[model samples]
Target: MNIEFTLNGSVQKVTITSVERALDVLARQCGIKSLSGTCFEGQCGNCLVLFDGKPVYSCLMPAFMLRDHRIETTEYFTKTREYSLLYSELTKEGRSLCSSCHSGIMLMGMVLVRSAPTPTRDEIFRTLSNVHCDSISPDDFADAVLKTIQHLTTARKIP
Candidate 1:
């Protein structure tokens, strides 16, 4: 099957088998390495991609499933102003110390913060629980969430 969609802001058309996973097509064929594939069982959030603006596990979504939808991966996040601010805040606070799980957790945190600016502590815990970054302490995650909220709040007030 031939699938055409905007990948990281570029219009791409690729011929892939119906059974092939979207992660494979994006990483191997389309040269999108940020969509990391680990467990391939959907348990790990490493293969996450924003499908039509909502995050989805690309490893579990077939290539044909994305035939007509927009797919935004981590690469796209790097180019966005919102994500850039989030990244800067995360790094400045030393939240990037968890090198192994930094990317996935950071991405998840950024999305959650944007969608729910004032998420409760429990909500923040729930969101971070899905991540496998054992190196990150719960307190550290909470601190990051709070810091992100502060950043967003200040940014909103500036303009």
Candidate 2:
């Protein structure tokens, strides 16, 4: 069957099998390689992607369920102004994330920043606990949320 959905701001129609996972369809069929998940059962947040502007594990999502849904990966995030701020802030703080969890952490961070712009450190760490990545410290996640909130606040006040 064919699933019609928007991918990174483009309309895409793909033929996939129900048994096929979204990770495989996105990577092998659509050539999206940024998604990563060490735990295929969805324990690790490595293969996270935006499903209708929310985080969902691509590895665990069935391909056919993607019909009419909008999906965005790191490729779209990298082009976002938030990503720029995140990169700069992480670099300035000397907290660089590993490639394994980049997509998941970054995307989830974006969602967090957008959903809750003024998250406290405790709240930040609480959210960070949900994202399972050994290399990314809670402080690093907190910093990212702060940077993203700063960027959003600044962007809002520019007018």
Candidate 3:
């Protein structure tokens, strides 16, 4: 089967079996270094990628399911202004996300903030629960995400 999609702003066409996972195609065939299938069962969220502008676990996504979809990986995500601002907030939080979880966490945080005008703490916490990293406390992570939302949505930063 041939799967056609836009990957990181480029149109990509790959011949893969219907059973092939999107995660394998990304790292092996497409050379995406930021995402990988750590826990092939889709529990870890390490293989997170935006499919058609929505966050999804690539480990469980079939290659045949990608026709006309738009995939966003950290390769393109890191270059965005949102990433620049979020990275700054993440740095100030003093808790570093391991490489495997960074992209997933960033995507999750961005999605939550963008999905609503003002997401409650419980909503942010609920979405962030998928983030399994232990280096940062949940409160701090939520705070950082909320702060980023404030900064992006308003001209003023939260003090």
lDDT of 2 by residue, 1-159 (tens): 888888999988889987999888888888888876588987877778889987788888999878899999878878778888876766564666777877777777776776754878887776566468777677877887797788779889998
Global lDDT of each model? Answer: 0.75, 0.79, 0.79
Q: How close is candidate 2 to the true structure, as a TM-score?
A: 0.87
Clashes of 1: 0
| Residue 11 in candidate 1, Cα distance off native in Å | 2.7
Candidate 1 or 3, higher lDDT? 3
Model 1 Cα lDDT, one tens digit per residue, 6-92: 887789999999679988998899998666777888777787777887778888988888787888776677766667666676566
Per-residue lDDT of 26-92 in model 3, one digit per residue for the tens? 8899999878778888788888888877778898888777778899876776766667777777768
lDDT of 1: 0.75
Cα error of candidate 2 at position 104, Å:
1.0
In candidate 2, stretches whose alpha carbon ends up further than 4 angstroms from where it belongs are none
Give the clashing residue pairs of candidate 2, or none.
none
Error of 3 at 12 (Å): 0.9
Candidate 1 — worst ten consecutive residues by lDDT sum? Answer: 93-102
The stretch of ten residues in a row with the least summed lDDT in candidate 3 is 150-159
RMSD to the true structure for each prediction, in A, is 2.4, 2.0, 2.8
